[model samples]
Target: MDAIYDEIRVALHAVWRRRWLALAIAWAICLAGWLVVSQIPNQYLSSARVSVQLRNVLPGQDNLMSQADQQRDIDRVRQTLLSAVNLEKVVRGTSLANTVATDRDVADRVAMLQKAIKITAQADANIFELSATIAGGGASDAANARLAREVVQKLIDIFVEANLADTRDENSQSLRFLDEQIAARQRQLQEAEAKKAEFQTRYMGSLPGTGSIEDRAGAARAQLAQVNSDLAAAQSGLAAVNGQMAGTQPSLPGTAGAAMGPARARLATIQGQLAEARGRGWTDSHPDVIALKNQLQIAQAAARGEPMAGGDGGTPNPLYLSLRSMQADRAAQVAALTQRKAQLEADLARLGDTMGAQPGVAAELASIDRDYLVLKDQYDKLLASREQVSIRAQANNQTDAVKITVIDPPTSPRTPAAPNRPLLLFGVLIAGLGGGAAGAWGLSKLQTTYPTVQRLEKASGMPVLGGVGEVVADATHIARRRQLKLFAGGAGALMGAFVLLMGIEFLQRGLVA
Candidate 1:
């Protein structure tokens, strides 16, 4: 323990003897570091703040963009603002152009600019903050402040343009696309209508919606009943004419009652049928009524036993002519009745078939109707969509629907934000202190003089009996020693300060260049 204490005491004395040297070294290093730090360009930070408001909506109305979606859009706009093209524009418009020409390529400058600018958004907040750090290009702090403010202003301009003008242009494009789609749907609707019209025209009578199958069947039965009645009257008249011709003599020409009996009966029946058709609203020029009238005239002529009118002809026996005419009339009546009966039968069969097919026809027609309705619905929905989109687009253009406001504008900074002079100087001072201490301790160890009796004993394995103090000098010698000490200290201090000052001047010149 004693030996340890003795060694520590001797080392302390050695450090005290070299204290001035240590102080000179420490000051030299501290000044040199301070010069280097002072020469580094200080950077100034400028910030611009913006707040976004989402769409204002009434009850039951949703915002055009949701909160998250709007945030994403804001993020996209932020990214686009920092895009290479925009950054390049900012560079060209700012003092960075000169800096870029002298310092680095365009790509490196762009990367540096991107690193220097920052865009940040707070969580669950509607505010965005944009910050840019500008290293004062020259030695003047005012130049850096002005440059930073200008660059941030440019970024704000880009952001505003992207939000407003770009959105408007996009809305215009959407409206145009919707218009095209609406037009196309309108054409398709027209085609569908045309097709439906053609279908209706081609199958008019049998079309499902024309009338019920039961109504059509009822009409067919009524017509069949009329035909049966007409056929029965025709057969009775033909029989009557045959009986009159066989049982009585033929009437003389121009006889008053010649057109009577069975022939009269036959004529009456034909007139009755014609009257019935007329009473049913058949026109005189209608085919069935016209034919019946012609038959009646021929029957009357045959009953009267008249000679060929307006013609030269031999006179024939009255009874023979009358019988032959009656026979011909009977044959015509039979043939007509038979034809009418066949037509009625055919009509009845058609009515039966129509009744049987009613359900299937209804189903097929309903399917057609459903298809037409589906297409019409689609056209209606498309028209509505086009209208809504157009309205939204117009509203967006006129109202500036998307809201972007600059809550805080960029401002010039009065102080340097970078190079932390005080902290850096303090750290350098500490390093210089440590270096000086290490150097002084090293130099003290290299000396050959044994300042301590214990160190001498340890080195040479010898015992020291006594220690001697230095001799006292005269007053003149003492004064000379003090003067020499002052001169050495002054010289060292001056040299160290000169070196530090020269280094600072060189650094300053390089920074300005």
Candidate 2:
């Protein structure tokens, strides 16, 4: 490294010593650089700015990109704006299209513009900007500006249009869902209304208000359980007739449904009384015994279905009336139970109609919520899509990022901003001086000089002599002076070449614009 540094230091000093050499090289390099700069065409730049946002449509987002998922969505939206298709359309249709720039050139310029565009992102933000620049002659400035404005405007239009399309879809979907619900509800309402109207016309000429037939039926059904319990107990008691007979005396002769036990029980009691009277050892002729025997015979006849002899006409016994009363009570109870069962059946029928027409309000609410959830998800997704396109568009082109608001436009240029003529002329003169100085310094660096005699003799491989002693001055020696004059003339001719080089640099810089 040190060696390299030392070499550079030496080169610098050498260049300094040969000032004209360095100056000549410097002028050469400057002129070349200038020539290149001049040849470069004067390009007209026109730019515009536009803003974007992705925000959830809650209330209003300043009427901008209002929607949730705005950042990622806006980024996606930018892609569409920066898309090759959109830029290509601008290239073909806009004022930039008519300029000297070709499709290939336009592509390259567009690519350069896309690279130059800037984009930034932050959480929960959807704002973005767009911009554009074009190269052309003086007249082309307006054309480029117009093209940029139109292209950016087109992008905004596309955004609004796309959003509207989505909104329309949202409306359409909601409308479809509502329509289906309304249609289904309409059918149900119609059926219910019809049923209610029919019931009113058929039964009372007016529909039952809330809790009419259904309420009554429900009450009746509740009672049905109790009624059934009572009926079951009655049936159980009736089933016990055989057991009652087995446990009872002859007063009941058969099972619950049979007869004859009451008569037999009275006959058996009368016979026992007769035996006790006889055991008293009374004669048959006695009035007490005869009286008892007469009673016994009458009771026996009655049990055997025979009529008893009496001074007065016979009449139906009071015990028979009691039996008839018991039968009547059982009949009345059975009839009452049968009537209640029939009424319950009629009430249940009425309840069925009411329940069938009833709407399921809770189920309807759940269905609506389900639909709304699905739509909300879809709305968020579409919003995200729009945002992404926007971000991509901004990043791809700086001008596309934000269309600038021009407060002042450019003024026309009279003389071209190039071709420093006087400067170039001064440069040519400087070059000539540099070349002459370099030639002198390089010559000075040599230790031996032909102008000196001692130096010349050593280089010629000859001995040094005190020539003063050997030869006298002559015309031949004087002729050698003529040869020296010719050499000086030849050296002067070489100086003309440096002057010629300087002229070339001047012309190149001055002529090109």
Candidate 3:
């Protein structure tokens, strides 16, 4: 422990003896450090804070934006904010425009602008901070601060435009497209309705899905069967009536002159032919139908003992009245059957017309209905989407939807944000101390004369006998000591002047814009 203390004391004594040289080395290192630190540019930072609202709640709608979706939108906005187009716009709008004289300079300025701007969003929140940094390489502090503030303000403007105007324009375009589609669909629906109406008018009662023509024809045939049964029953009743009056009744005068059997047979044959003609889809105005009616009239006239084309105006015998009455009743029954058969034939003809058009009309109507329905469905979806987009656009325009608003405006920073002068100065001071200590140690090592006998023995590994003491100085030694003092003072003064001149130059450069 004593040896260690002795070594420390020797090192201290050596440093004190060479103190002037140590001071010169320390000051030189400090000046160099200061010059290097002073040459670096000062950076200024300007920041603005904003809060964005996701959505506005409205009646019958949940307009709240989801966290993931909002985050994605924010990411997209951030990317757009840093895009080359927007960066170029920012450059043109600020003092950066003055720095660009050529295409390459513009490109360089844009790159610098991108690196200087920054956007940050709070997690799970709608708050954001936009910041810009200006490194004034050779400019003044005031210019750096002003440039940073301007850049931040321009970024805020871009953010607002993206959230409002762009969204509204997109919605307007979508609404126009939906309107055109809806109009086309409406025309198609109208055309389908017109076609269905025309088909119904042409086919009358034979529309598919309403009762069919074959059904109506079957119904007419049923009515014809019932009429025929009634006619047969009436004939049987008339025959029975005639049988009861056969021997006791006297013949009528008209019946006594005419043979009723031949005339009755001929009328029945004419009636059967007319019924057959009517069943073949022939109208009452058809030539075949007209000829059948003429034949039936002639047959009926002959039955009454008149000329073939005219009815008789003669009287009848009283005794034959009973038989004639039965015959007349049978004739009336046949006439009623014939009328009913004609009515059934007319209905069948009408039903056949409806049946003929049913297949084609049903197919065409189905195709029309399908087309109309498909168009209607698409139109409805497009209309609904347009309404939703319109609502969102309106909300944005009104500042009720997701939008960025300036919460804290940008301000010119008063202090330099870069260089960290105090820290740098402290580091330089430490380095100065180290350099001074190193110089002293080097000087001590170069000296061959050992101040102590123990140090000489340790270095040379030889035995030390004794040490010699120096005599007092004479007048000549005193003069030499005074000259040495004057020389050291002059050198110190020159170094001090050099450091002062460098400091003034550094300060001047720092002040220029």
Candidate 4:
């Protein structure tokens, strides 16, 4: 402990001996540091907070923009707020414009502004914070502070304007594009309709049924089977009626009333059925009508050969007459069914011929129909989209979709936000003191002079029996005392200068405010 204390005393004494040189170095270092600190620019910051809210004018509609879409739009604006174009606007609208003389200057200003501006959005909220910084760049502190505020304000205006104008412009362009597409689709639909009509007139008109030829053929086959079944039933009924008629007598032996025989009854029934068939839109060339005519001729001959049952003979056998009437009705039914079968078979044959000859007809027709339907569907969708866009555009024009409220207006800084001038000045003073002290200590180490007898003995490796203190005259002592006062005055003046600089820095800040 004693040795350490001795070393410390030696170092202090060595520095004291060269105190003037230390003071000079401190003065030079402090002055240079203070000057550099004065040249450094102050940075001022201005910031604003804005809350955005989306309004839904049309409720319960799928066409309205979703929350995600609205949020995306807000994010897009926030991300682009610090873009070059917006920064240029900021520069032009603020005091920074005065510093720009040419396009290059403006570009340079914009580039600087890009670094100076910042936009941040809160999580899960539509609130955004915008801030701008302005550094000295040869401008006064007050001017830089004012420019920072102006920059934030200009950005706010741009943000609001961009949202409003972009919505309208985007909607307008979308509607115009949809309309053009709709028009084109409409023209295509008309052409498709015309082609379909022409095709149906030229080919489908002669066809038996609607739809493809295969479908017609299937329908014809089904009808033919049904007709064949009905014809078989009718023929069986006619045969039964004929057997019953053959078993019945034409006349009763003791009857005196006049009545027609079985053959005449059969002839009358056939004529009635023939008239009924004609009434059902059957032409004479129809198989049913031809068959009825042949039956009529056969009944007439039978009636002429049969014995009459009238007033002097006997009443016609009632059972025979009934059977003859039933036979006539069944024959008529058989003829009608046979005619239906022939017509169906003829239709099937024609369809088969068409299908075999033109295999691509069905494919071509399907393709045309498919194209027309697709076009129609696209036209409908485009129309729907157009309507939705129109509604959205109208809603935007009528009401505010995105409402921006300035929660915190741009603030004019009352003091610099950067440089920390007072702290820096204090640091320079400390550094200067340290550097001067170190220089003196290092200079003392290079010299051979020893301040104590022990240090002299250690360096020279010799025994020193004693040491003597220097004796001074009264005049010399007085001169040394005056010099000590002068050194004290110089060190005190350096501290006073540091204090004075600190005071000036605060005063300038006050003036700026």
Best by TM-score: 4
Q: Candidate 3's residue-wise lDDT over 21-83, tens digit each? A: 776777788779877876777788899998887654343433544324445666677768988
> Model 2 misses residue 253 by how many Å?
40
- Where's the lowest-lDDT run of ten residues in candidate 1? 307-316
Q: Give the C-alpha miss distance for residue 410 in model 1, angstroms.
A: 1.6
Per-model CA lDDT versus the true structure: 0.69, 0.49, 0.71, 0.85
| Candidate 1 lDDT by residue in tens digits, 1-513 | 998897777777776678667667777887788778777787888998988776743213334343344457667887788998888878888877777764356667678778889988867467888899977445366677778888898888888778777666666876787678778777877877776666556543543224334555567677678878877877776776666557643333433323335665565567557644643458988999889888988988975673333323332334445555656876797798788778767766765675465556545545566677887887788777667656666665666566778888997776667766556766777777776666777789999989877678878898889789877679878887896698578547655655665565446434533
Instruction: After superposing candidate 3 on the true structure, give the runs of residues whose Cα lies further than 4 Å from its correct spot.
Output: 16-24, 55-57, 65-74, 180-368, 446-448, 460-463, 472-513
Tens digit of per-residue lDDT, candidate 2, span 1-513? 976875556445564455545445544644564455445433323333344533232344422453343344445656666667655655565554665356687886467456533333334244334444433434433443444455555555555444444444444554556556555655655555565555446543322333344445567787777777776655554444334334434332323333334465576555545544443346888887788778767776776783333323233333333334433554566567767776766666655654556444224434444554555555555455445444433332222222223222232222223344445545544554465555545655563434334445758878667334336367866875675575455434434534454465455334421
lDDT tens per residue, model 4, 441-497:
889999989899998899899999999999999999999999999999999999999
Better of 2 and 4 by TM-score: 4
Structural similarity to truth (TM-score) of each candidate: 0.60, 0.35, 0.61, 0.77
Better of 1 and 3 by lDDT: 3
The C-alpha RMSD of each candidate to the native structure, in angstroms, is 16.4, 20.3, 15.8, 9.5
Counting only residues 3 or more apart in sequence or on different chains, how many pairs clash (N, Cα, C under 3 Å) in candidate 4? Answer: 2
